[model samples]
Target: MTLVRVSRGVRMHREAEPDLAAHVRPLTRISGSCAASHDTAARLWNFPEPERRPFDRRIHISRPSGGARMQRPGVVGHRSRLLPDEVAYVDGLCVTTRTRTWLDLAEALEIDDLVVIADYLLRIPRPEFEGRAEPYATREELLAMLRRHPGKRGLLKAREALALARLGADSPPETRLRLAMLSAGLPEPEVNKPIRNDDGDTLHAPDLSLPEYRIAIEYEGESHGNADQIVRDIEREERARAADWDEVRISKRHMANGARRAVEKIAVALRARGWRQEDAA
Candidate 1:
């Protein structure tokens, strides 16, 4: 077996690329004080960043304020006064809790990006698919975290993000679309609200909907480009048509220029469905 050196005193088979856990676990084990934090913890919790980037080579480790600073070749060390509950063990590796990770991210990301992550954390999880019934974190819990760390680096950004964050946004794009519409002076749409037929059977759960105007907005991400998903999307559009709902389908192209194009598409659909510009005001 060919062994590749990953970190000091740590080696792995060269055939397999080291995953986040593989890279961080050893670094955390270097001392009881160290825990995975910042971008590293966000990745572990599956928070969606504004833009995708290659996995950073350096591991982010945090120790208590008085702990000795880590001097390692591949580690970015931080010193903060962490509450006992702020850090937890995930899959045997020490890491900051989900809410703390978001606070850490607020320092590095824009307000929109922070809102995207906040939405991700607050979205209800599908127990059947996600293996858990509860959201990753809640608004109150996040607020409490903010209160605890009044002097934290990104307190203002985190608070702003929390104010904009809402439940039911399933993806970053969905959250961005909602934010864009708000920015364009459109009426706020319900997130992932189910539209049902007269008999009360659920027909479609649109990404965003204005039930009063029968407008359904769907943000189709990259997955929707697949042949199989395209067929399903067509069928979904037909259902909206049959139900007399104006369905606005948005794609990556529509997300250009701060999602101005997406807002325009949705605005047109809303107008056609009897929404008026003055109504939004």
Candidate 2:
């Protein structure tokens, strides 16, 4: 079998025959109280990371001030004086709690990066999660985590991103679109707004919406262009228009120029539907 070296300490089979998770699995032992933290823990928790950031093969484990400095191959260690509430166990491995992970990431993430994570953690009506548990953590929980780390290095950026985080953003692109619109001075639009036909058939929702103006913003990924999804999307848009709602569809290309084109199209659609441009001005 052909092999590729992902890093000095990590190697992978060129073929997709084995479980990928096995490749990055760490051999770690904490002396007293230690847990996996940061990106390593993120992988364990199934958090969606930014596309541009790579997965580091080095395992990150954190200690809460009483553990011995245990060392192993491919392990990176961190020490923080964490409170009792900040640790959790999953799949038999001790790990930082979800909110604690968010706080830890503040030292490394940008405002946009933090917002994307926050949006994911607080998504409303998470159909993908089983048993109806809270998706990640609540907004207030995140705020309290920030409060516990008042003087942290990235506090300002984290605070800015925290203010922008909202529920109902189902994907990274949708969250980025919301930030773009707000940065461009447009009124904050509601995320994943549902609609129903006069006959009570539910269109379910669009990526973003302005209810007062009857505007819907949709970000279509590559899958949306698939023949089956295309047919369904066309039907949805046609039906939405027939119901007097304007649909603004965005794709990867529209995300260029800082989403200027997408924002412009939405602005024009809003104006046609009775929004005053001066209100944004």
Candidate 3:
């Protein structure tokens, strides 16, 4: 039997073969063929749990000589047309496209898992095969799918993906906070808006702000407690104080108790800033 080298010690014949044990051994790990559809596809597709074994299924490989078939006894072959750029050679097997990865993930994922997978896929940098894949659709079609399914897990995933793709590397925390606030029936604050001083110099851009009430709500995550961040926070507070803006900071702890107390605190601050209590209510 002639063997062609693919990876460090992996080999495959120039022609197809029936048993691919040697080729399958190294490629069965997490980062290897498991990431692609093959056996993993069954899991993603919600197939019945199979009894634990050494390998999942055998895959078929083609051989060059006529009538000489080599069947890999325990590997399942994932058949899909891949774009030239999407095809990645990892460990001796071809890695599937991100779109294919997501599709497989969607097939077996529960609602929440599906949403997360969709969100993660959308957030990936320059995701290849998005519009070029088999289920071809224009960007509008994709957006329409999201709009049609608003408040659904699929829509949440689509929205998250769109935001990540468009915003580059910005954290999604602010967006999530805003969504949670809105869902709780609070008026949406202007996002990432700058608070300026009398001299027109920008003081700080609060994550959320109410211009009329001179109120700001800042979401303080763990990063805020760092030494550099503490200094910046002091400066921001001083600027806000000079500008007569009442700043309210909310942490994950505050949010954990629900937005009632946070909302009430903001409402009181707004009232003190000459905003009508009724208007705030």
Candidate 4:
């Protein structure tokens, strides 16, 4: 019988198929009551990450103190004292709660990367939630969680990232772009800003905007390339122009390759419309 190794001393039929999170789950159990946490827990809960890792990455697990670390060929174990509320279940899989998983990421992620994940968790999908999707975790909840772990390894970085976390980002790229702008010393623009005409009727809302400067920065996702979306985009551009707003559209290519240039263009537009460096303060 040919068996594939899933984790140290754990194996299964080669044809049994594998789900990354599922495969990771048993490792936690085999290690004696640990839970899939950190990146593994985040994946099981569908948490948005700045970048998705590969299947081959080691499974991450966590447990309370006084237990043996789950050292295995394919597992990376974390030892932490978990609170009752910090452990939860999803689809019957034991994992860290949302805020707990996020706190776990502090030491493992860069400040900007941490902020991206933080913003993602707080995003509220009002339309999908019948005009009120409660946030996955409020900013206050995150701050409180950080406060509880004062001596944790990366608590300071976590606190800083949580401070920049906002509730309106719709995608990881939006969070990335916003951070880029702020890093460039630009004032934070409103996310999904509303546009209204002289009569005060809302026309459209752009992805990010500085209303005082009448400048909008929109992230054009791959879906924007479709014929129907392209047509609508053209119309949206025209309406934005009609509203006397200058726009700088950013795509994944711009984000991955020419982000500096894209952000500079936005700065130029902002400056042209009277934004000063001191204004950001």
lDDT of each: 0.87, 0.77, 0.50, 0.80
Report the alpha-carbon TM-score of model 4 versus the true structure.
0.90
Kindly report which residue stretches of model 1 are placed more than 4 angstroms away from their true locations once superposed.
Answer: 1-17, 52-57, 197-202, 225-231, 274-281
User: TM per model?
Assistant: 0.88, 0.80, 0.47, 0.90
TM value for model 2: 0.80
Sorted on TM-score, highest at the top, how do the candidates line up?
4, 1, 2, 3
RMSD each, Å: 2.7, 4.6, 11.5, 2.7
As a TM-score, model 3 comes out at 0.47
What tens digits encode model 3's per-residue C-alpha lDDT throughout 30-64? 23223235334333323333222222444422122
Residue 179 CA error for candidate 1 (Å)?
A: 1.0
* Of candidates 4 and 1, the better by TM-score: 4
* Poorest stretch of ten by lDDT in candidate 2: 23-32
- Highest TM-score model number: 4
Alpha-carbon deviation at 257 in model 3, angstroms? 4.6
Per-candidate count of clashing residue pairs (backbone under 3 Å): 0, 0, 20, 0
lDDT string, candidate 2, 1-281, tens digits: 78876545446678845332354343323244667787777777777775546445567877766665436566777777678888776545667888888777777777777888899899865555655756788999999988987777677777888998988898988998888899888878998868766777777598999878888888999899799999999998998988878899999898887789889989899888888867878
| Model 1: lDDT of residue 4 | 85
